[model samples]
Target: MGSSYQLQQQAIDAEIRSLEGSIRALKLRRNTFAPISSLPNEVIAIIFSFLRARVTLFAIKPGKKPDGLAWLRVAHVCHQWREIALNQPHFWSHVDFTAVSSAGAAEILSRAKTVPLHLEVGAPVGLWDDARFGPFQKELQDRVPHICRLAISAEPFHLHRILKGLIMPAPTLEFLSLASENDHRGGAAFVPDSLFDGSTPRLSSLELWNCDISWMSPLLGSLKHLEIRSPFKWPSLSVWLDALDQMPQLKTLALHRASPVAPWGLIPSEVERAVTLPSLTHFEVSSPARYCGFALAHLILPALTSLCVVAESSRRDYSDVQEILTFVSRHAHGPQDSRPLQSVLVRSNGMGVEIVAWTSPDVHVELSEQISVSDARHSGRVSFSITNSDDWSPRVDTGTLSAVMEALPLDGLVTFTAQNRFNRQFWLWHAPKWPLLRHVRLTPAAERGFREMLMEDNKRRGGPLLPLLKTLVLVDVALLERRNLRLCDALTKRVEQGVPLETLDLRKCLATGHAIELLSKIVVDVLAPEKTYETGSDLVSEAGARLIYVEDEYSEVEDYDEDDADTGSDDEVQDMDGDTSSDIYGEGEAVYW
Candidate 1:
């Protein structure tokens, strides 16, 4: 009987093996007829374009297999894909000389045939000294005329040699960006006019970082977009006007850290006259805290729709802020310029202070050091931002923020979004009122401040602060029952006082189900009934932008106020337009407000 059992087992094993073989064969046949393999070359070409779009090719290490290049992976997929990719000249147009394999780049160049090339040539840190760049340099010389868009970030010496080697003008070049690999503050290499023999008429957009160019360079004549950064020699105000005058079609101009050669406001009278840019629409300037307003003070942009100014200073400098405010007031109220500013963005991050304010035609005003913008024109809402700055040295004095608020119209403001705790401090200090404010979005830190501000107003019998505020949006804020009971009480008191907060939307909030239930009884509508939801990871808030600090050595946490009873009497609603006094972080500390 044992022998019979062994024989039976052997027979079963043989049957299983036979079945497995048949299954393998079937799978192979099915894969051979797979839908993807049967796709037409035209269809595959479209798929290849989508896959290879925006790919930045880098030089492949000698022995290591290239990993990130999508074209290489596609070519290796199958013979058909390789053939289709190699035959398409446009597919090989964008070449990154820095990371491309010596042999691989040549192959791509050959396949690229007569297609307009977009070349990026740069070597990272240690690779700048490598001998492999010799061949790539020669290839670049051969391909310059065909290059339509070129971006080079290399050692200044290497850049100089490369530009010097261009024996012919790049007739096809339209956009050019040349930047130094090293940080050479005031020692940028001078780009000689003879590099292109004063040719390059098609160039419309030019960006230079840590490089020198003559103000009279022919390249500036037809440029529509010009960006100059950390120029070695600060061009005289008159030189700037002359250069701008040559570019009739210039629309967007940005000058970053380009201070005047002379002291601030000492430009010659001729250069000081405002030069009008008829086609200019967007203007951006960032300069040292002391001279952030230098460029705008010298130019006039009548068609300007968007303006962004960032004043950066390492030490305390109030002059920069004052200059910015003065510049805006002068241009915004000028009678000759009837165009209402569609948007205004001003920020100062220097020393120990940070302040950001953004306003547009549709939205009235936003103020706080933390960045946030709300686009609720359809809903008629405005937003605000706030954040705590550690190492708060009070540099780049924000006294200008209050002045900015006073200069703008805030009566129609409807929505306010607050981000960080310090924003609450800014708000309490400013005590600005928007009679039409109806919706408010708050983080936990700001929530406490909001409650306190509202409770302070509830104490007095005068017109309420934010009387029309009906909706409250809480984002990623936790409510502790023991400590935050007063928050609920404040809402209850405000509701009882007639300015009822109709909706309480708990979004991505960490509140206990019981706490949410309790709050539901107070507010008419409570969102997030589930009491839990993942917070949105979007850094950009509803307001459009928010400023975040990566490193702040000092931060403090305050306990939530749990007291439900109104302990203090209401303070009369102070006029937002008038100067108001309030304690800053300490009893006697004075702030910009």
Candidate 2:
């Protein structure tokens, strides 16, 4: 017992000694560090403030190390950090409780103090019920009037209670994003005008996804930016189009992503005359693959600096290219001060191709590329967009694609983008030589045609195929059964032609070992002839491109069905412009091999 008492006394003595040492150091060092300690409090506070806000309150689940996660990890470093974190009330408002717990939520809200909050709740339907939120609900209700922004993503049933329970109004709320990934969860009743009543006098922006709302009420007056997706199934587009007529202050409007196959043509003027929105400047509309159907020129904003149309391409050939071309022509900036209708993105969903143009002409392509000896020599980042470059389809081959690339002016383009722009069969005249070409993006089907095109048999008076081709990118390449003369044969032919092929990059997409074996042949043949093709178990093909191949094994899933492939939505309606919406497109017949 005497020995145990000695041990406990020794621990107490050590703690007391440490405290005395700290006190002695503080008293002696106060004068020496006075200048540093006297630094501006606001600046010191900012430095500490930065440390506090770095704590991440929410991370995207299945969380990879993104910026959000990195920021959150910075908070747990030390004791000083924990103190600075609790002191800054604004830091608590940015708390994202997507995958956090209820208790964690209360802690976050508590730390936020009385500062206006920005709350984003992304929880599954069952997780955020009125009962589940009962404890925080009342507290949130009490704090609602102080909230600056509130974004809640829940089902329709829960949304009703949430809207009703919102502490009798947030007059300062400025932004709201409400939706459910599960479409059936939101409807008109959940978004009654009373939700955006005078209490929310400052609400300026609204974004909806898979929300079902009829905009027949008086919620349209002061909105500056209004975005709607899946406009109806809450009812119809007409309900909101009716409200837009009265929104005099509206500046930006984004329509729902229309069905790829739906007969959505240029809406005529008479239909648009219902509302005169003189203040509108930015407009985004989703169209079917082709640009033929709908017209929006009548409501064209005189002050419009940017116009974006995401059109579905029905006719792969140049039938309505003129219509889209004309729309672009009509909307191009006239004044030098005007924004140069700059970017255009054409993505193919199903067979219905989408053409979305960005109005800022000065913008570079958003796609990345390989830097060449030449690009490095020039300087800076080389961005490329599929829509800006040549044809970027997943079902086309690189070697054969060169022919299509022949039509573009490639003097300034990078080699790979220049090569892909004309996916496979690049005509000899266009690429006379591959300067920037590095990779070719394609699917297994294109791989087959590519192999066949390179066969000693496919002699069509063309020289060697894709001599400069190096890599192949499969963005959404699906892992499916093989159809081939082998990727080995394809690589070997490039080698035989003395063409140097290097990497077959399909990092984002997957293929089989057997497919990998074929790609691995570049070293044996093209890269270093002394090397041999080492086979592996990888599939060659991936599926993002719309494809339909008539072969031994066929499944509805394997077929690249255009969104237009099969649907009862084909029954058409005439637009206000006296144009037959169905004239340009008809039924989808089986495509023969």
Candidate 3:
């Protein structure tokens, strides 16, 4: 009887617990919830006023389901939430005319008041069907000056409404980006030519992407930056180049070509036009160089400072680098009238055809070993990175380095990298001590540290070992295996005894489960896996440090496409694993290389 009574008591307890949970949930959902007025009105206004572009008609939300007057019910369910949402008029300013019924458009307008409004219409069918968009148009036209920004697709009616209509000049317009095209036979297909003849003066930034234009003239005299991306619709590079030539105040320019044009050489000629801009500082161009038949045989930009060439849908041609050098040498010649460029950058960008910045002359090298580039150009800052996997024969490399060492202003060359051949004889030699190495990069097979016999090898040539090295970049290394320790230990010992190495960049090198252990034994000050987080100290130097882990500085390949369900251009790029690249730079450390 005692055991049975205990069981009965437990059953009663369970029933009581279930009842309490239901009661709590009902309390949270019902009209019993607290009122928004309960909080200070200032707090409520601050919270709701900032939700402009995001909160549209509360009656229709993105990917959310509501059955039968749910919004009104929420207001009626509890008085507080309704009051907070209702009092916030600015929250209802943006009207997304996507799903809202035509009959209710006027009702939404009534709530919007005279405030500046943003209207986004996705379905183009509503353009001419005045029954649907007439009320919304009336609201937008009334507040044209307040419409600081507008994004509309190409359709005859949209063009007529926005362009042809007596559109008041939007003086406050700071940015205008259009991908104008038309499905209607008479839409603004030739609209840019007819409507945009240097008319919009206040527009400071323009991005033309696949925009068809008979005449590419733009009123961008005050424009500071311009981006033109793969205009498959464009006929000639002349229209674009002419537009740029007219813009006297342009500071930065980015050019990207997507398709194969009939006259491929036009773009190369157009790039040469940029040499005319005395104010042009930063220029990045991505195009097919091979099709650009002209070798930049003779040209120079006296004012050019930063240059980035990314080959897009095009392979890198050795001739491109040759052309640039020849042009710079010829046009920027003479010790008296040379414009010294502070930064130079070139990249093939993709894995296809390679860009050869360093070429083996027919004679293997020019024997002049004492080249003074500053006497020739005066601009001391030079940064060059070329990626190509070619057979740089030992003799050719020695000759090339001899030429490079002669040509380069070594002390001024702060950052440099040449990644292709690891077994080149130069790797086996050329200690940076002559220049007192600051930054050095060696490929996978090029092991760090010299063996005893190797020192004797350098001695035979009287080449000094680099002792004051501060930084080293070792990439594409297969150092995870135990056999690799032979090299790792050698590097560690050299750093501790010979070189006062402070920083190491090991980008894209693999790491095993016991990576820290292997590295700890071989390197000084190796941060333990448990202590892998970055310290708050700048120049985090520990005296007598043996070995430490410096994060690799290589690009991490992304294995994107999360759902396998949607890989469209619109879906945000996602990785199966969380973002693999999260290493941030140290706060105040000066990166010398």
Candidate 4:
């Protein structure tokens, strides 16, 4: 009886297995008839490539590992997808050891076949210790000849070992980036002379962070892009010049705290010869003002289209500021002098001061439209930023800033934007320098001082200040009570002098009904916020108070975007007014009370 029962159970299990097989067959057949399955194999492979391309292995937060293999879920969707993904060697060419387990790494390597691999390893700090990294290290050592791009972020000891293992020639390598996870200066890793056995012919881009290499390394010969941050040691000025002379094809060079230290008793005549970088278009340096000035004095960039200098100091004297300004004045002309300076924006606060000059008026239009300058691409720009580290709430050095403005070649400037607070004296003193200025945008903090300057200029017996000024923009300012009356009086004086403003824009400002009436009467066209809060009873609405508070918070902040200088083409100016048609700023007609 027991045998009979066992036989019955076995028979039932066999039938269940048969049913499962049938079910899988039916699903496969159904998938074949689906819309996506009808796509040609090559088209399907292209779609898969795009999906894989979107998954990157960078920028993972702390205490987390990269999951770049998530795109492989497409292979599990159907049998056909699995076959297609396995057949395409390029799909599995990128192997991130930290993201995959030991078995998974083997599978990826097997599937990649002979395709040139783009390898990323040892990121997110604590993941790649010596024990767990041994097998992968061996694999990388064997595959160095096939790597196209390699980026590794590891601690000093581990990086040293990894570099020692990479002694073979890497003829296929094009891009290489090495970073030390340890922040201590003493913990920087040393690059061995045998790296790629000094035989990387295709190398074009190299970035080293906290790594020390010889200045005359063969790997630095023909690089097009070079970025070094926090190097183990700073070379002398002459050594840097010699290294730069080797890379005439370099297009972008960025150094963060990696510039040469200032030598004592250095005279201008000692380093009269400047290393000319003819192909350099974008140059950036962040260091002490003295070091930055010393570095800029020794290099000549004839093809430079973008320049960025960030100077930080604790001294009261601003001689370094003058040196930097001199460099900018020399290079303000765009590449080959094809584009001239057209717009300038100055932003200052307790923490720092930033000045940006562009060769196109459209940058001002884009700023007026509230597009972040950091995201825009342009051809010509010169930017400067200086900060004081002694005091967080220190007063702005108007004396130094005035010199900076005076040094700028503003004869061709057409648009100017001033943000944050500047004392009345600063504006009154420098207002006349911008004779060709046509468009001006002033933030809330700047509005009062600028109004005072205009009023004071009216009192003088000379010509009107900013005689070419056509458009005036007041952003996040309060136009209520006494402030409104004083500003209107200033505008009335301008109108009386026969230099009426063509357009008046009040953006995100709280104004009483009487204020808009007075402004509309003086300006030909008024652009006010869509929703205006009339504070007739001296009671502010919640939203209006919130706006004022936000503006106040931003008043002491440095709002300059560095990326704006390196981007934006000549064609982007055509769409600068794309946001003007929106209802946020109301119609182009006057706003009645």
Best by TM-score: 4
Clashes of each: 17, 58, 12, 4
Query: What are the per-residue Cα lDDT tens digits for candidate 3 across 471-552?
Result: 5555544343432454455556664455545555543443443554555564555423222213312323322111232211
Candidate number with the higher lDDT (2 or 4)? 4
User: Can you write out model 4's per-residue Cα lDDT over 441-558, one digit (the tens) per residue?
Assistant: 8776566557766765444437887888889888767665556777788888888877888898886566667778888998989887665665333556645554553433423321
lDDT values, one for every candidate = 0.60, 0.46, 0.40, 0.72
Question: For candidate 2, lDDT tens digit of each residue in 1-593?
Answer: 99999999999999999999898677656634656445554564576555443422222123342232233443564334445556767767764556456687778788888888777666576766555677656666767777877777666666666766663767778777777545344354346666645357788887776665546544445688887766445333354446766677888777655322223554342443434566766666554423212434434455554455544333433234334443444443434223322232222223222223333332232233332322321221211111211253232223212212222223333323111222122222233343434444444333333344444422343666454556544433433333322445655777777774666555544445545555565643222221112222232213222232222022233322323424322233222133222222334411211
lDDT of 3 at 189: 29
- TM-score to native of every candidate shown: 0.73, 0.54, 0.51, 0.83
lDDT of 1 by residue, 1-593 (tens): 99999999999999999999899688657655878978888998989987865633222112342333565578876557788887888888887776678787888788888788887766664565546777778888888788888778777777777778876788888888888667443245667777566678788898887788998888788899998887767778788778888887998887776755436553232343767888887666666544545666777777765555555533343433544555644443333333333322232323333322324333323433222322221112111111222356453223445455544444545555544343334555544446666777665545655676766553443666777778877765555555347668878888777887899887555555667767888888888635331233343342221122111112222333324334212223344333433323333322331
lDDT of 3: 0.40
- Of candidate 1, the 10-residue stretch with the lowest lDDT total is 377-386
Q: How does residue 104 of candidate 3 score in lDDT? A: 57
CA lDDT, candidate 2, residue 431: 33
- Winner on TM-score between 2 and 3 is 2
Off by over 4 Å in 1: 1-44, 55-68, 183-187, 259-272, 313-319, 329-400, 407-411, 420-433, 456-462, 475-478, 528-593
Instruction: Decide which is better by lDDT, 2 or 3.
Output: 2
